[model samples]
Target: MADDMTDNMLILSMISQVFALILRSSFLSGGLGDA
Candidate 1:
């Protein structure tokens, strides 16, 4: 049970990180385009 919980947390963390990276890159591109 504990292992399953840990796995889930890890998966969530990875997903969030990926989303953050995508958002950051998109924002940068948008800023450059605006300039």
Candidate 2:
């Protein structure tokens, strides 16, 4: 149970980081990475 929660949190954290990077890059470059 506790382990499940930890794993979920870790996954969420990584996803959030990736999402944030995409958002930031898109905003700065004015492109949604659809080169």
Candidate 3:
């Protein structure tokens, strides 16, 4: 049970990281395009 919980937490963390990265890049691209 503990192992399963840990795996789920890891997956969540990875997904969050990917989402953050996408947001960051999109913001940067948008700013550059505006200028």
Candidate 4:
């Protein structure tokens, strides 16, 4: 059970990192277009 929980945590962290990168990229593109 502990190992499963750690695996889930790792996946969640990696997903969050990817999500954040996507958001940052979108924001940058939008800003550049607007400017």
Point out the higher-scoring one by TM-score: 2 or 4.
4
Query: What lDDT would each prediction earn against the true structure?
Result: 0.87, 0.90, 0.87, 0.88
Candidate 3 off by > 4 Å:
31-35
Decoy 4 TM-score against native: 0.83
Q: Best by lDDT, which number?
A: 2
Per-residue lDDT of candidate 3, residues 1-35 (tens digit): 99999999999999999989887887888854654
* lDDT (Cα) of model 2: 0.90
| Model 1 bad stretches (over 4 Å) | 31-35
lDDT by residue for model 4 over 1-35, one digit each (tens)? 99999999999999999989887887888854653
Over 1-35, each residue of candidate 2 has an lDDT whose tens digit, in order, gives: 99999999999999999999988888888787653
Global lDDT of model 1 = 0.87
Quote each prediction's TM-score. Answer: 0.83, 0.81, 0.82, 0.83
* Model 3 alpha-carbon miss at residue 27, Å: 0.6
